[model samples]
Target: MHPTLAYKWQCVFIQVGKFANEVFLLLPPYLPILAGSLSLELQVLNLAAAIVLIAGKAFWLKSGRITPTDFLATLDAYIGGGTANQVRVAILEAFKDGIGGIGTDEWKEAFTQLVLDNQMQTAEPLEDREHP
Candidate 1:
């Protein structure tokens, strides 16, 4: 992704993380009263809160923008083989040119080809039969 767009997304993620943290903090004080009055189990509420907090934290970390190492790793994964180094250099250059990064065309094309190939592979075999 473009650095500017990545930066923007990072800021947005940070804001979301802050909001989630505030919500998580507010949940604890109400837990006792909610559990007692609503006849709900304390364990269930605690578990749900824990899951939300963990997911929120993970999102925050993942959306904090990609580093150079991350970019290189991702490029390698997407364009594997002997051309990986060349692909990485090209991708970095594209990003530096403010080109908004690589498009999703390659991924979409790969997915489409995979589907077509699978369909062709699984097609029924033809058989010759005499008709009366």
Candidate 2:
């Protein structure tokens, strides 16, 4: 992938993460009262929230803004080799968890650590690569 395009997508992913966190935070206050007054269980409300979030992510996935190949390539840039594959798997799992559960700092840290620990796997020597 082109560096500029990849950078743009990286920013989009960051913004999506922020938006997901905001939605997660905003729902809690209203969920209980809304569900309780409707004579529904809290779990039902949570499920509904999950459905909405997951549907949004599914829409994004289906919209073709990011092709699977480009997504994998972008991930490979952050991390490399087999560990990148693992991170890819983790991303799929997160998708299953819903939008609010995806793209957290821990996921980014995992990629960063993989880059740090596996620098030797890349073409350049550790000394030649940019350090954080």
Candidate 3:
């Protein structure tokens, strides 16, 4: 379940991370210890890295005038063929370039949704949505 969307959808049993055998990376990212209790989840870390990878791919995908969605929909391969990896990569890439290249309209919309999800996790909407 998405964070801000949690208010709208409860009783969810979301793993909040990679579900498919394919992972964005072979190893988890390194993290520095923080003061107090501040910490970021491994899922979020993977997402950050994935966005960079997806953004680069989206740049090329759109240049070819092929939406990631369309490309992914046509994939016909088995697990050994890395089909799951393809879906994971293409979906994230598609999200970044649905309307424009990475960091454009689609990226903005997705970032907005992330903020909204964060707000849903709290009682009142966060006045400060910016990251520290």
Candidate 4:
């Protein structure tokens, strides 16, 4: 090969080596940060999926189902804490007392009665309610 051509080739090789070395040197610091970012992203995805699942379950439970468990889930989600929770606890306690002896048909009857009782209470006017 010509001396000039050899020197040019040598210069190209040297530049390629320097570029490769720079890339390798930069990787050690960036790799951990990249890995950490990926890990955080996965964790965020997992949390989002869990939240979606919970919301979907609540929505499904509230979608006009007549099952007792579905009704209770809706009640809990809607009413939350305080007096509402007290009412829920009271209803559960009362139901549990006779639940062991009751069949499915009785459970439905009790639920219907409870709904009717609530409707009657809510349907009364304030003046009439004051007397009751």
lDDT of each: 0.37, 0.41, 0.34, 0.39
What lDDT would candidate 4 get against the real structure? 0.39
Q: What are the per-model C-alpha RMSD values against the true structure?
A: 24.2, 17.6, 18.6, 27.3
lDDT of 4 at 8: 100
The positional error of residue 112 in candidate 2, measured at the CA in angstroms, is: 35
- Output the number of the TM-score-best candidate: 2
TM-score of model 3 (CA atoms): 0.22
For model 2 the local lDDT of residue 24 reads: 52
Q: Which has the higher TM-score value, candidate number 1 or candidate number 2?
A: 2
Clashing pairs in 2: none
Give the runs in model 3 whose Cα sits over 4 Å from its true position: 1-40, 64-132
At residue 97, what lDDT does model 3 achieve? 34
lDDT of 2 by residue, 72-117 (tens): 2322333323433443344344333433432578655543443344
Candidate 1 Cα lDDT to native = 0.37
lDDT of 3 by residue, 1-132 (tens): 778788545423332133121222322221121111222332343244334433334334346443333222222111123423443344454443333344677566765554333221112222223212
All candidates in order of lDDT, best leading: 2, 4, 1, 3
Q: Give candidate 4 misplaced runs (Cα > 4 Å).
A: 32-132
Clashing pairs in 4: none
Worst 10 residues of 2 by lDDT: 123-132
Q: Per-residue CA lDDT of candidate 4, range 3-22, in tens? A: 99999999989875775465
